[model samples]
Target: MVYSHSQVQLYKQCELRYAYKYIDRIPVPAEASLHLALGTSVHGALEFLYKEVQRLKVPSKESILEEYHSIRNEQITKIQEENKRSQLDQQQVADFAHMGVEYINWYYSTYHPFDQSIVMSTEEKVFPKLDDDIKFRWQIDRIDTQDDTFTIVDYKTSKRYPKDTDETFKDQINLYGRAIKQNYGSKFKKLIAKIVYLHLRNEIAREVTDEEMEKTRIKYSSIIQEIIKKTQRRSNGDKEAFKPVQWYRCDSCPFKMICPLFAHNYIHDEAVNLDDMKPTTIKAVIDEMAQMAYEIKRLKEQKDSYAKILGNYAAEKGYKRLYGNENKVIIGKSENYSPLPEKKNELESKLASENMLDDVVDIDRFKLTKKFKEHELDYDQYQDLVKKSVSITAQRPSKLKEKEIDEYMDIIGEE
Candidate 1:
């Protein structure tokens, strides 16, 4: 399948989301937001601005703003008509329009006269074939030629300006540079990438090194290969081939109604009648589990508060145990030992000299368990470690309502 930078990013963001969008071909209604509209309008205006520059004509601020408004208005109308559920209101649209004007104005004033470099093309499409089967199709906002060097310029309407060390954007732009280099290597000796953050009125420009280009190629190609592997596994009926990764963006994900991580949440929210949630069904179980989890969390919070007070009182009185009429409360304390930060090396060296380092150092239980299963360790050694370190934790489940539990527990009695 053909890929774009966005598709690669989507797969990186959440593999399940990529599978839903690409593999399953699930159709989620497009969400039109003011942010997207503003970005599009701004990009369109900038494309117009640079295209004019390419033709030896620099548009005035008024002209650019006019173009921006035209595009913004058209986009707003389209969103309002097509996306009836869109949350963007008139005030937000106007504000975003004004923000777009500000960005264009700042960008124009910062680099006026438009003679810094020769504009080779605006909104240039570059298709770089990775292999016989893999190809990426993307568009650069603008391309400039100056001093035998090609500069890939990308505009950003994002509020947050990325740092110099932000490799996500760096990798994306470098990929663009690589595409340009692959397509037109004979024309230029050097390549540069310029990311213009319009909202923040900032620009980050860097030379696209050959090392970065190669790294970008390998990194993205590996991601594509991973996608291929997951796709193949999915075709073979592996249900968990594409795991959903939770992030802040999951709250706004369009696939929440169907995504395994979040589908349960919407099951109740989207249900219509009592019949939709039968008591014997998984939906009922899910709802009950949710309620139990919330109740447990609340009870834990209260338990923690009481425990804190009891702990403080026990410490103040130097008491190990407090007696009630029938039930007794026990307060226990234990400290874990670790080498001091300043003298850890000295302590480790001393332990090593005495050949007692292994005795003191904690075993990685996970690795040990793996070794045990692989029969890498002798049964006696495994059993000794297990007896020394392993302990079973048992927990019992209970359902308790807020009204059934007492508001407070008396740990100390009056003298």
Candidate 2:
């Protein structure tokens, strides 16, 4: 099994999705989204320009811009067939194009290749093997040697810096340091790694401490072991086990139509409605749904408390508001509205009247019951009933821990 930061992130998100993507080898169409294409083109252009500069070729800004334009145009043209008009607007296209240029310019300006001497290597392939049957392979964007230190520089196109401590970022850097040690001899006295958030215009740099590097090795080893276990399980006929975990990204997932959990009637209906909605409108709906879910949770809790209080005052004829205005609300018997028929009692009576009972046929079973007590049924039948009776809403996972954040940052550095 080969592991990368993205693979780890995907595994963390949903093991099934990771399985679908990597283990199953499901083909993903080449993304034609302008924003994604623009990012790729910009990275390509920068890589080209940097390599040229590394060779002592001081190309003018105009020449660099021209090369960027050529690459950008080619990419756009190649994706034009798949480009739905609604997928990207003129303004978005122009904005991404401008962003690509800005990123390239920032790369050139921030790290002047002409002035700096090349040391380790550019786009170096490093594969670190673990005790488990997993291989971690990553390509460094650029590695430079300065005095007694080895600096690993990774260029990022994103505008925001990761919201984490410097120590967390160092773990990622240390992985590169370890990779370097494994591949090259441990001749370098110091190892420095940096993630250049080009859009944010911030370079988060950290030096790997000895203790931190050892921790990184252990962490990577653990991850490798987990990956191997998952891979082996997948290979042993657990196909559905690799199903993509449904997340926010699932809405854009190519296999949404195939996913059993996310491909239900409600999700299908929502997908159809979403196709007709504007992006902003869809976003607004999502926000409203989040608020509604929170409100529902609060309302359910209040309802539960109210039910408890009502049980104590079964003889009472009035309802009282709790924790709000000190106003009393009365519940009176009503004759104007018809009451709903008791379906459970009707079914019970029908079953009793039939008198065709067997050991498995219990008349008392025909009652409205809570879901949690339905464990007598098989798992699949129980799941189906639960799906029909209630809606399952997903909440955002807990915040990334300090150590996890550092590991992610390290992977970003490698990227």
TM-score of model 1 relative to the true fold?
0.68
Candidate 2 lDDT tens digits, 1-415: 6677567667777777677777777998765677667766766666666677667787676677788888888877777766545454678778889988887777677765545645456778887654456567788888878777777888777656666663444555677777777775466787777777878878887776767767877887785666666577568875643545557787677766557754432231132256656544433465567788778888999987886676456436344433337755343333673324767566556657887435325434334243333323444556654443556765642333565445445545643
Q: Could you give candidate 1's per-residue lDDT for residues 175-252 as a string of tens digits? A: 788789888899998898998989888888889998988888888888898899879878899768788999989868
Candidate 2 segments whose C-alpha is farther than 4 A from its true place: 84-88, 117-119, 165-172, 266-415
lDDT of each: 0.81, 0.66
- Would you estimate the TM-scores of all the predictions? 0.68, 0.61
Which candidate achieves the best lDDT against the true structure? 1
* C-alpha RMSD values across all candidates: 10.1, 16.3
Report the error of model 2 at residue 182, Å.
1.5
